[model samples]
Target: MESCGMSFIKYLLFIFNLFFAMSGLGIIIAGALVLADVSDFSHFVTSDLVGPPIVLIVMGAIIFLVASLGCYGAIRENYKMLVAFAVFLIIIFIVEFAVGITAAVYKADFQETLKKSMKKSLEQYESSSNNNIEKAAWDNVQQKVKCCGVNGKSDWSSTPMSCCYKDKMDESDQPEEFCVSGGRNYIYKEGCYKRLQMKIESNTKILIGVGIGIAFVQVVGMFLAFWLAYTIKKEDESK
Candidate 1:
């Protein structure tokens, strides 16, 4: 009964490791697909597109190989093999953590740059155009617009500034939030610019989230590998 239980546990661990490794592999493949510059593959590394971190791709490959080795070690009940695989996982985790930190720093810098660029653009638009109609449109947007870090809440509101916006809009139907009541006799030119900036800010947040998640997964994978190896080694020594 004891032997059967141990066998079952080993099988379970193997499957768990395999599943994580497989998931990592899939991430790698998807990342690669995005990285490819073939005619069929839209250049995935564009500033607009969210591409997986290159460090993640490397770490994922390492995790996948370690998981494959762990499966083999479980089948053979070889403590030495398992220990080797676990050590590799630990190294990969450290590297991944370092990469995640670097990514986070880069994101901060990028966001700072984005805000500065947006401010400069707004200033230029204000300087170049002086028409009252155009000025009114910009004035409306300025009143309603919340910049990347200007307001704490109720930011990024996409309310329409004028009725002219409805006719010139790409889509016939606009969301309630984007649609202003009645007919807007005048439209703000800067409104769309501010909206575009808001989208860029939101996307930066999403990329930051992805980097954090990858870092967490690497930490978890490292811990599990080490714990499993220690337990398996102790069990073998007892026998």
Candidate 2:
């Protein structure tokens, strides 16, 4: 019965590691997509905005490698590999915890920094003929968030078309009529900075939650790996 139980645990660890490996791959892909999409706008975006995706890709790669070690160690009953996997998990857990805490501690500062960056981008919007990526990013944000400028509509010399009230604006209306004349009433009142701050806060919370959950799982996996390694050593010594 003891041997059977050990075998069951070994298989369970392998399966868990396999699943984690796949999740790591998914994260890598997501990170890659973010990096690719933002590459053209690197000069305009703050380093903070560009850093996460690169970190995600690197961390995902590390996770996949560690998970592979765990899976193979369990399958082959390699005690050294299991120990190494546990150590890797401990290191990763510490790093992730530190990152999460830092994010929480500097949340307000990050928002303020991002707001400043957005303001700079808005100031250059009309004059930035060399970089369409930055312009497109701002336009997409305004259209999707239904907000204009870093502060308010008056931040722009003329109201952006993205801020035009959809109900009142028509294809036949000239830009001067719908976008300039009496535009304050037709444009969205809220600033893009506030909306962006809310979005950043929400995403940061979710990321922190996910990091905690993953760290918990890594702790559990480390325990299981060590236990299995001990059991294998004991069984071998008995022989």
Candidate 3:
């Protein structure tokens, strides 16, 4: 009955590790996609913004490798490999915990940092020219987010065509004069910074939650691998 129980745990650990391996692969693919898309808007993204995708790629690769170790160690009942897998998992958990704590502690600063970077980008916006990625990014944000300038309409000496109200737009494909006209009230009053900051916070919370959940699962897998290996070792000694 003890041997049977050990075998069951060994299989369970293998399944857990297998699932984690697949999840790691998915993260790697998602990070690669993010990196590729961000490259197109490189001028708009700050160094801080670039770090997440690269970290994701590295963490995913490491998780995949450690999961393989766990799976093989469990299946083969290798005591040394199981111990190594547990040790690696503990290290990863510690690192992830530290990161989470640091992020939480510095969460307020993230908004300020993002706001400064965004304001810098907005100060450089040129509506007549779409030749640069920064201008293109701002145009897209203004058009899609339905917000004008970094703070409000007053930030712009002349409103960009993107901020013009849809109803007042002329049939001409060229830039509308209504956006710049002092008599017109077609410009959006809200700032893009608040909208962007909200989005960033929401995404950050989701990623942190996912990271914590993954780390918890790794901890469970570590215990299961260690237990299974210990059980196998004891059984061998009795024989």
Clashes of 2: 0
Clashing pairs in 2: none
Q: How well is each residue in 9-119 modelled by candidate 1, as lDDT tens digits?
A: 567667867776786786576555444421111111135234443444665677687788878876776777767776776676676567557656786565555455444
What are the runs in model 2 whose C-alpha is more than 4 Å off?
Answer: 29-44, 126-137, 168-185
Per-model TM values vs. the true structure: 0.51, 0.79, 0.79
What ranges in model 1 sit over 4 Å off?
Answer: 1-5, 29-52, 111-167, 170-220
Every model: Cα RMSD to truth: 9.7, 5.2, 5.6
* For model 3, the run of ten residues with the poorest summed lDDT: 174-183
Can you list the residue pairs that collide in candidate 3? none
The lDDT values for all models are 0.52, 0.75, 0.74
Candidate 3: regions farther than 4 A off: 29-45, 126-133, 165-186
Number of the candidate with higher lDDT, 2 or 3:
2
Among all candidates shown, the one with the greatest lDDT: 2
lDDT of 2 by residue, 62-131 (tens): 9999999999999988999999999999999888888777877877787777777887887777666666
